[model samples]
Target: MSGQVRNTTKIVFIGAGSAAFGVSFFQDLFATDELAGSTLTLVDTDPAALDRMAGLARVLNAATDRNLVIEHTTDRRAALDGAGFVINSVAIDRNRLWQLDFEIPKKHGVRHTLGENGGPGGLFFTLRTLPLIFDFARDVAELCPDALFINFSNPESRIVLALAKHTDVKVLGLCHGIFLARWFVCQILGRAEAEVEVAGAGLNHFQWLTHVREAATGRDLYPELRTREKAHDPAFTPLTRRLFHSFGLWPTCSDDHMGEYLPYGWEGGEHGFDFAGDDKNREYLKTLIDDVASGAKPVPDDWLKPSWGERAVAVIGGVLHNRHRYIESGIVCNRGAIPNLPPDLAVEVPLLVDAGGVHPVSLGPLPDAIAKLLHVQASVQQLAVEAAVHASKEIALQALLIDPVITSTDAAVALLDELWEINRPFIRPCV
Candidate 1:
């Protein structure tokens, strides 16, 4: 492995203040000798968070026995110069802003179990962040023309699509959706640890596994999963239990988080589902900010754990060793990835990743039932990206009205108006 190493690559992480993900990705990057002399730049607007991450990077670099050049910057453009790969992990102010994302929708009669994935909340977030992402894309075009942009931000597919449609930068969206799906498979199999083969493709947060098989044998795993659900295991999380009961299909994401993405989960008044009054998003953001600001070690339980974010590591490994590994990733453009969807829409699918770059596999067309749901969410993502690039409130409103959670035109309009007013300071002006 050491002798198979190739040229070092410059990896720049935007929003390095995000401790949980930043630390995990950095550690994963440092683990391989292939990246021994690589340049690692951490960029963030928050000085306190940057400083803490810088310190953590130093310790990890030394511990890994790698001569990695770790640097920190408050300015994103400065950090991106001459980089080969750029990872975006940014979020708006954690607690206060996220609370608004979750709470304001409730006032407008829109319910969202997960505030950040897909809903009025997710749409508003994309509206505010897309402009900033495109700004970075423009800079990358000028400074790092050949860089591979990996976006880990919320509204993942929308952001990637914005870059693909509006900019020339080579971009791929990264999320832990597949990893969560694997976790569910593991739980359902009743094995402490089991290797399962799964394939899924769709827009972010809406991805569905088409097949689940046991790696050791050629046997299908879906039947076993269905049986486990029938037995009613209390160990299954609330969301999974509810999904099995209602949808007759187990979901890949947690119950609370999956609610915002699916039309049935939050809308159907069954299994005691409550989208409003869920403070987990707020608490998670607060915990993250405090963790990074106070130099808090090992993120709190309230925050998302980063153990499952393996794309960065996988990317680096593939590049360094010229080894191909298949992982499901959210990327812009259909291009035969999902046969049933439009060729231009962004879809998250399994890809063959290597030094050559990511190539998404075609899952053919999704079942019409799933495609309809995906189409609704994908439209919102497309419109939000358009709104950001053009700075058009009308496009943003279009995105809101098309969102699954907002049922009526009046409800959609009211929610859009409130979001527009509340987020005015953050939204970029329409040109």
Candidate 2:
């Protein structure tokens, strides 16, 4: 495998309205020499968003002096044709509907730490989004059968697993959970961006770093991280401080965001962000829409810069340059990838990706407790995918019930009912 273009690759971004992510990914794609001749298709329902993304792509292409051919479309099928890779990043207008996901759950006396993942909100999101994903998958099967599908949406592992079990499309899920793991280690060690050694493996947003050591001394940093939280700044929450003390494990996500997923983190006045705070999420969405509609704001410097999303770039680079790079990706259905989990399940693990193709490394079985927790979440994801494929409201309800954040059966049922009612217009009925 040498750095040579064996074939022209077509990469499609499913939701180009997500300019922040699109810009980041496109910049990374443009930076790599292997991706220079690839065709990038930006697909979005919103014409304005697609236009904005086109502007960004042009700026990036000019800056990098890359010959990456850029295309934009609102039709999924048109954008998907002959694509070698597809990346999904769509969200169902959270500002307008996410409040319904949160409010209805709270009405039933169910609390969620974050509405986006691991709760009723996430379930509803899955319900709404999975149908679209399956629609894309079906099209990919028919039109781009040999292409690799990469999901960048939330509940990534579940989504990928659902697709793998239900469709023939080659799929992988990806997230920045590892970046958060690095941030957690840095916070614990009180170091200002020191080089460190770390190893993490597990489901998205739930992976734990089993090893954290100083790069210089090879000294284990976990023990010191365990003890020092007590003396650290009071800005950190007690739930987080205690989690570090008890689990002897620092979580990949922050306390404010992580609290919603775990039961004990938010019980009895525990310090955490309110689950109903859709203010920021809504504001960001509004800003994006407004900027696109009015063209009144200046693009941020960050938007003009490049990013390091490794998967797409690595694949393109490998295919183009024949440079084999190891990337941690959530690939579906490798028998030995994770020892204890069902071989059919999609597992997030490190894989050696190069010009030849993607390969998953077997991390062996996860610890029993972690595997148990992941199994629960994975079940919800699987069920959600099934619901989308079959259009079964019952399966969607079951997925919500299986969710760890929704403890009470009655609450789960109620939230499910509300979501069904709210999302009835968007969801295709299960046959």
Candidate 3:
């Protein structure tokens, strides 16, 4: 399939309005000729936001002479009938609910660094988001079973686990976490960015960096990382450095995320994460979407910075061209990819994407100690998914107990009651 062009490829964007994600997803499509002429169907429940992104798609494509076929809808079932790839990046009042996700956990005396990915807050966020995810997966099963379901939703690993384990729909989660691994390598080595290669396997937000080498020389960089971490400043990445010192392997994420899974995650408390600031940025993006579309705010002349494009477009392009590209990390069901993690768990590992579809690069086996640490949380994630799939409050309570932050059954009960009461309208139980 090398150099092949699927001119009529249909790629659907679900939750494009609730902002599961939207059309700049196609910046890569516009840049690559092979997929430039493909069809894009945008599905979002919000007509206003959907229309705004559709308008921006026209603005972007019009700048490129409009080679792609673009359409928008509030109906996902209608759009799913023929899409070759269904990318899900849905957010429902993400900023507001996310603020709740962070605050309510704090109120229950559970401090988490990043509430969206781990800890009790992660479980709550999963409960709110997974129902919508199940809806999309169920619809895909009925309408486009052959379509590859690529998710960019939060609690990424858990959502993938739920869909992969419960539904027969093919699914994977994509995140920029690996790029963070690459960036940290460059920072520690004092080298140019993207000049290093690193790999590890574990649940998303909890991956360990197994090795680091020079992209050009293939020289192992682990020794240097260890030396630096041994004397690293507590102010820089205390939790991450502490993990490296204790685990004998470099972890791939910052304390902001890695801390989420650790008991001492709230060590720095208000000093560590900036959820409020992050919500402000999300608000800016929301406002900018409308502003950019209406010409009230100009799209940055340099907005198309080279990122992994959230990995969806890159994987699609790689498969279309049979490029056999090595994506440093992708979230997929274990399926023996790590040989140690449960096959139903979502593990972030290196992958090869090409004509045959995406394939996980086996990490052989993670160190027993690292596996031990992750399995604790993997158990929590597995139960969380089951809770969401069955909408079983009993399972949900069990997941909360498995969370490292829930020190007492009393705290778990208080947190669950508070969260359920607050999120009642948003959470829809499938059972």
lDDT tens per residue, model 2, 220-264: 977777677667776655565565555555655566455655665
Candidate 3 or 2, higher TM-score:
3
lDDT of 3 by residue, 1-431 (tens): 89864545788988777522453474555555666788888888889878977887766766666478889988789999988899888876777777777777777777677677887778878888888888888889899988889898788898888888778888878888767867876776787766788888887878888878888999998887767655655676666776777888878677778778877877635343465787677567778777877888766554443235367778887876788988878899898999887877899988999888889999789999999888898998988878776777788899989888677788788878888777777677743
Give all candidates' CA lDDT scores: 0.72, 0.69, 0.78
Positional deviation of 268 in candidate 1, in angstroms? 8.3
Per residue, candidate 1 scores C-alpha lDDT tens digits across 1-431 of 56764578788999988866775686566666767788989999989778877776776666567898989999888888899889888877644666677777777777667577677777878878877787788889899998888888877877877777767888888887777877777776875434777777777766777777888886888888878766756655666566556544455556656667766556432223233443565346446555644556553332233245467767656755677877656566777778777777888888777878777877778777777767777777777777776778788778777777777788778777877787777788422
Off by over 4 Å in 3: 1-6, 18-24, 268-275, 286-299, 429-431
Flag regions of model 2 displaced more than 4 Å. Answer: 1-8, 192-194, 216-219, 234-241, 265-305, 308-311, 329-334, 429-431
* lDDT (Cα, 0-100) at 382 in candidate 2: 66
lDDT of 3 at 92: 64
The candidate that wins on lDDT is 3
- Write down the worst ten-residue block by lDDT for model 2: 267-276
